[model samples]
Target: MTVLLRSSTTLAALLLLLPKTFVLGSVKLVMQNGGASQCQTLWAKHTIAVGNVCVEADQRNPEQLIVSYETRDGWKLDDAHLWIGRNISEIPFMADEPADDSKRSVQQQQHQDQPYQKQQQVDLTQFPYKKEDLAGKHENFGFVVKLQHLGYSCPDTQAFVAAAHATVTARSSIRNGNTPTLQSAWASHIEPMKKHVLQGATMINRINQWQDFNFTLVCDIKNDPPEGAPKRHFANQVPK
Candidate 1:
């Protein structure tokens, strides 16, 4: 019957869509430039619909980069920021931290010794972004980013965006075949919504140096909550 056919089609479409909607996780990154882009302070704050998500980030380590978050119960530390680095080992889970702070002390010592061993790198072969070249280095030892939008969501979005806000771009490589490289970049635009502020992120990358492609990611935030909704008081809730 016609109705049976329609039901079957709907079911097939949903079966294909479910996997895409479920996100593994997310990050909230706040890069606070204290008047100087070079030496500007970086804050790895937690993901918040609006305002600061972690109490420690707001109080104890007010200036440090605190990438914390809030669940249904309350705020907690979020180590998702480590994804920016090529090695997941660099940013271990909270449980991995030792009891007496010995682990942290060792990490700090190792970090002090490692200079060129940065958290990020650039790969021209992978074609991470459109015309993504090192613009310049900041005073605080970070690189200035200059890239075009790809208009599509690919593996490069995470690295490209993180390079600008967080640490260096540590991993970049070629994929598929031995070609020149893919040219892609994501564009950032503003879209106003009734209940939340919408940010449309487009990815525009060079598919093969000869052709171009595009992708989009619409980031929505509830800037102004209604009377009944819980009020967000933190100013550093922006996603990384």
Candidate 2:
């Protein structure tokens, strides 16, 4: 009886110490920025690639903000730098990519915990290769990005990391009861484009008011191979 009870106690302690694991299909998100405190587990969108969607409402406003993941399509967020971890994340959409054009000095780039392989942030605004290079290529599976007032602008960042999981808090409001829909919120972030004849360097459309946020994304690379390989080189292999 003593030995059995001791074994049971040991097993219980071990289970308590185990790190929780979540499958790709199940993920929960909590946000305190929508005028109230809330946490929600996001539902996976019906697609082969890694993307998800959820609808949330903010207090003192008529509309809710649409949160979605952009693993491949819809990666751009107007002219802002594409993802987190970098100072400026503006991605490239119009320029021609050259081969062997790796930016970010090895010493300067930051590193996050596993699942998120280091050296994930590549140059987005300037291309060294063509879109044809990524034929049938898939991006990493998990990344929850929140674009604030982003629109259909040229050269958007494909992936970025937030300091933590999804959460946004803002104190300002236009309060037109706009009911921030996916299409409407996206349209609100759009900037005027240049005429075809006078296409030139990219310009930015600044928001009238400044909204501050405190959150970060922990973006994972499509490939996390061993032996210090860049994310583009391997499958989802990371240190055990």
Candidate 3:
């Protein structure tokens, strides 16, 4: 499973419209650089399987599942941040704390020690999905009603904040008048949530496999702006 997951490159690309169809499918974690996946699975007996995960769906009846991921790399995350928490409201960890001086010093030292610093590769197709490749499948915000991680289900949609880590995949929906630029911007903003999320996804004590975990992003929630306030998309973020 580890070898197969790592070898496949399509899973990490959230919005890349491949030649084949993209079915909003099961969720998976971003593949790490080392032996994290192998170590966690092999040593499962020594540690907990699920930690800080709660996406809801009826395993027996797969039809009940509304939330689904676009690709293995559902959300746009850097090498540092991968699979994040269920909902935006759930802060990953010490979200507010300033990084200690020691941590910063170590990172700087590591950079100095490295012979050659590698740059994060930017996917050309990441922002503007080639119109030709889409095959007429317009982009729209699919509602993520709930999320289910390893051991828990995050169904508390009432308090849900912004969109979390997952990427905005192509779906067969009417574009209406939605701007692609705005969509790209929104994806960029949510990219940071994945940093430090590995605590929940890595190690034997945590969920070793975040592979193919799916959730539903609730769509068409009207913000109903009053007196011509700024137009909004997500109903969850609108004020009461």
lDDT agreement with native, every candidate: 0.23, 0.24, 0.26
**Candidate number that wins on lDDT, 1 or 3:** 3
How much does each candidate deviate from the true structure in C-alpha RMSD?
A: 24.1, 22.1, 22.4
How badly does each model clash, as a count of residue pairs?
41, 24, 28
* TM-score of candidate 3 versus the correct structure, residues matched by position: 0.19
Candidate 1 per-residue C-alpha lDDT over 104-220 given as tens digits, one digit per residue, 9 for 90 to 100:
333344454432212233332333312223321211121111112222221122221222122221112213333322212211111111222122232222121111111112211
Poorest 10 consecutive residues by lDDT, candidate 2: 1-10
Q: Whose TM-score is higher: candidate 1's or candidate 3's? A: 3
Off by over 4 Å in 1: 1-122, 132-227, 230-240
lDDT of 3 by residue, 65-169 (tens): 222212221121111112334453332332244434454333444454333222223332331112223222322222233233322221111222222222232
Predicted candidate 2 versus true structure: per-residue lDDT over 46-144, tens digit per residue:
112222222223222322222332333422111122123333333323433443324522322232121211223334334221122222222222222
Q: Which parts of model 3 are misplaced by more than 4 Å?
A: 1-114, 120-137, 143-145, 150-186, 190-240
Per-residue lDDT value at 184 in model 1: 23
lDDT of 1 at 162: 25
Q: Sort all candidates by TM-score, best to worst.
A: 3, 2, 1
